[model samples]
Target: MASNRPAESTSFAPSGTQTIGFASRTDEGPWEEWNPTEDSVRPVRGRHRVTKQRGGGLARSSTVLGVGVMAAVGAGGMATAQTGKPPVSISLPDLSSVTDSAKALIGEEQASAPKGSATVLSTAGVSTTEAAAGTKNAGEALRARIMQQAESQQDRIAAEAAKAAEAAAAKKAAAAAAKAQDAARTKAAAEKKAAEAEARKKAEAARLAELAKQFALPTSSYTLTSRFGDAGAMWSSGYHTGLDFAAPTGTLIKAVHSGTITQAGWAGSYGYRTVLTLDDGTELWFCHQSSISVTVGQKVSTGDVIGRVGATGNVTGPHLHLEVHPNGGATGIDPMAWLQSKGLNP
Candidate 1:
């Protein structure tokens, strides 16, 4: 078995007093107790020589302690494997002491290092600070760009909306203008139609007025007793075929127009009658007259006294019956209408 005690020193030492430097034994003094210290010991040479180190020798001591701990853990593991035994727990020294020693060594190493190496470390720190500032500036720039883009998009949208509104307003205005134009055209057409109608009416009046100058009433101071187509038992036909003008006896009758007398002194039921033929071959008949003043085949002008009004054959009072025949036909038309055509109201 290996002993845990330290091995005894093999160095030689004198147990009692000895002669100094080959002197006589009578000159020797009494011997005293001897104590050994570091100052009293002499340094060894070769590989065992002890050299002084800086940092109060803590660096070397700490290095030896770390190596010894690693060796001890490795030996323990080997023993456990070889002997088939459980691993023993090892008690480690305080880590704080090792840490302080390592700090002290680092401080001495930096102090002895060159200026260029220290500059490199300082430059690295500055670069780190610059990189952080650059990151922050980049973030701010990006935010600003995003805001500007958003504002531009919003402005574009607003412009488009305004453009749309303007387009709608223009369209509405165009439609309103078109509607007004249509209304104006309609009003103009109506006014044109009315003007044309009025012009035609005036032209007709002028034509009738010219005809009135060439025609005259057959008798005056008379009242209309009957009209053509009047139904009565006093006439031979079922309806009256001529217009009647009631007046006092001896009322002078006049020629209706420039015409030649065709018949006078009527016979039968007609007490007095006269027939006049115009240039157009239209015949005018004056019946129930009191007297006849014009002769047959005699030419007369308008307003010439032709006869007088009186009660004649088949007559109930002094009245003149007038008839008109176009182209001397057997049938006659209404004298009132024929007179109105000559522009004479009566």
Candidate 2:
């Protein structure tokens, strides 16, 4: 380290005794101090020349040498601090040595640099601009990829929704078809039942018409004055056992069916009477008649005139009482019902 102490100074004698000499040694010969004069000094041979100034100051070459030494010392100190290494010893250089060393260092730096390194450093701004452009391109590519993926997802969802809707519609259509089929089946069954009923009714009507051809009404132009089983004081059996037909006294009575006249004539309260016996053993009796036109044991056909209506046998007016007996039983049955069985409405 350099000290902070001041440098030693030498004082020269005053004006008139200025001549002084110093003993010095030189490469050429033994040194001798001599007063310097322009005539006594020799001209330097190199490009640089040393000359004494009017103010007795150092030469410009010496000043340049001092500045070079300071610069080198400063640079060495800075390098030591940055590298964290022990400081290296530096020797002060003579004027000629400093110049030669600076030239050599500059040459070495030029040789160590890589090829085209200077050109690359000079265009550094261009590289920064290109890097920014590359980043922008990459961002655009990423955004495009994201958009494509979103679109694909949307399409998938839409397809699924449409498929579901179509399935629901198909199911609804199937249900409607099933309901319509059931209705059609029910209607067909109802129509079949109605047709069967109509057919049965027609068959019954045909049967009744055929029976009407074989049977006949016993009388005409007469009103039913009394029905069998009627309760009245005029009847001997307490309840009437025969049907009565009322009309003018001359109303003719007919045989209900083809039968034999088994008995004819008056019998007590029955003023005039006639009995008809059918081949099936069913008997028909006519009473309260004005007169009898049939005789016993005589065969008569249906619709034959057998008697006339008259007020007799404890009757209130002119009317014929008719009775029916199935298989000739003593107790007679309702004549009106028997007439209906033979297809007679009267």
Candidate 3:
């Protein structure tokens, strides 16, 4: 858009012929002479040259502080990084007392920035030495706790095993004791039985000896002329029925066994005879006796004189006829065999 208000004009005064003019159509035809030339349009050199401005002290100091903040984070200081507090709000560490990388970073920051001024970034990042010490302490405490637990568990297991072993040993000892006790009881019982058997055997032997002392023979100092069971036709039954003891007349004849005299008088064909009946109903016949000393029904002991030997019956010489009737049987056992059976080989 064109402005319609007053055009701005400059008031000027000319020195000699200075004037302002407008070009007509004739003058506008070829104005090559008015074109600019190189030398005439060239820029001119001036005396003044641009210089750099001085920067503010605050800006440089701020830059140095920023560097210090980053250095605190990398310097391994406890007041920075892992402290969790704002870096500027954290306590400023004593540079002289700081150790390892923290001391080095503090020195650099002192040279670059201001004295006694430092930033805390992260303690985990910057406080290398203290952080490692804390980690090691924690690991050691944990290891000690684990070792204690393991030892306690081992002790408990060992105690249990020892208790079980003791129990087993006690059980074994009890069994052994019981076995020994049973063995002793059994041995005692066997010994008692043997002792009783020996006592009974000795008692039986004493009784048999006493019985042997009580038995006796009918007569002594007599010659055996005939034995029982000898074939003969002179007596009844056609056999020698009694043992014949050849002796002189009036030789003593005693009771062969303990008995009572049942007959003490003359018997037909036997002359003066005596019959001794024993306790078991066995009769002992003493025939051809000259006389009888024991009366009838008189009790006699073994080796008691009851009669005298004489040849009064159907005999060829003076002798004693002794016959045995077992249980009152007509036949009797051989006297020699009977005597041998009683442990007397007659």
Candidate 4:
């Protein structure tokens, strides 16, 4: 069988005055205590050496250093936590911070983010600078549109008003021209009528002067017995209204002027009278004629025989009673004065 006892009396000394001996349980009595010399202890330094400590070792020191580094990192992370700052930030594509400079470069990465991230960015609140720019641009566009419309409307209205004014002026001018033409026409017509009236008046005056020269006395030899308007018992209207020429019967009675014979026959109380009418409305009566020589409407020359002289028109003697009337009135004027106006002395 194999023994399991220890060997006896192996001694090793460390440093001064301290010695340790090793023995088995069956070793003899009277052990010796030895002292170590001064040359036994030496400083040693090398790689891959095992150092011995009393209780604590290198594992404890390494654990203490790791705990201190973790505490410092936790404090730094806590300090920036309010601002959402990360610890040890790196340039990893998916985990990068949202910086102002990096946000402009998000086009390529926008598709990789969540589906609604692009929508959130697009609908974000506008800054004061962006809002002011948009307002200025919109106001300029609105003002341009309004000004264009107002200018177009103003031009149209002005053109219409000008056209209306021109039409009114044309109408007024036409009315004035028509009035002038009408006035000229009226003046011409009035002048024409006045000229015709003057010519007719001159011709009538010439004809009247010629007729006055042709009239002559009714008898060559006679005596004026009664004058015109002699109030005596020989008149029916209370007056002798005509001149009585007392002449012998069967004497050649001549027509006073170139006139038509209106009557050459016997009248009541006037035996064989003849009435002659001239163109100037004068009437001559030769009454109590012995014989008639002309009929009605027979034209006779001056001193032409119309009837033989006798008594006529309420006469009493067998004598020629010659009377003259200017306008066939019942009253008569003095034959002597009327003959003198015709350049004849009765």
Candidate whose lDDT is highest: 1
Q: Candidate 2: TM-score?
A: 0.48
lDDT of 1 by residue, 1-346 (tens): 8879888763234344554688635444454557888877865332232343765745554454454345435554321235568767676554443555555554665576565553111212432235446667877999999999999999999999999999999999999999999999999999999999999888878988998899999888999989999998878888899999999999999999998999999666767889999999999999988899989899999899998998988888899999999999999999999999898999
1 or 4, greater by lDDT: 1
Give each prediction's root-mean-square deviation over alpha carbons.
Answer: 19.2, 21.1, 20.2, 26.9
Candidate 4 weakest lDDT stretch, 10 residues: 118-127
| Alpha-carbon local distance difference test for all models | 0.79, 0.73, 0.72, 0.66
Please report the TM-score between candidate 1 and the true structure.
0.54
Give the range where candidate 1 is weakest over 10 consecutive residues by summed lDDT: 119-128
Ranked by TM-score, top first? 1, 2, 3, 4
Per-residue lDDT over 314-336 for candidate 4, one digit per residue giving the tens place of the 0 to 100 score: 67765666677887766567776
Scored against the true structure, residue 93 in model 1 reaches a CA lDDT of 51
* Tens-digit lDDT string for candidate 2 (1-346): 9879898775443332332376433334233456999876876544343343444323332443344445535544321235668867766544463465445443443465565543111112323234345556777988999999999999999999999999999999999999999999999999999999998878866776777776787778889978989998878899999998888998988887887999998877877888899999988888888989978999988788988888767778998888898999999998888888667788
Reference-based TM-score of each model: 0.54, 0.48, 0.40, 0.37
Q: What are the per-residue Cα lDDT tens digits for candidate 3 across 208-259?
A: 5666577676777889989998988887788888888888898999887788
lDDT for model 4 comes to: 0.66
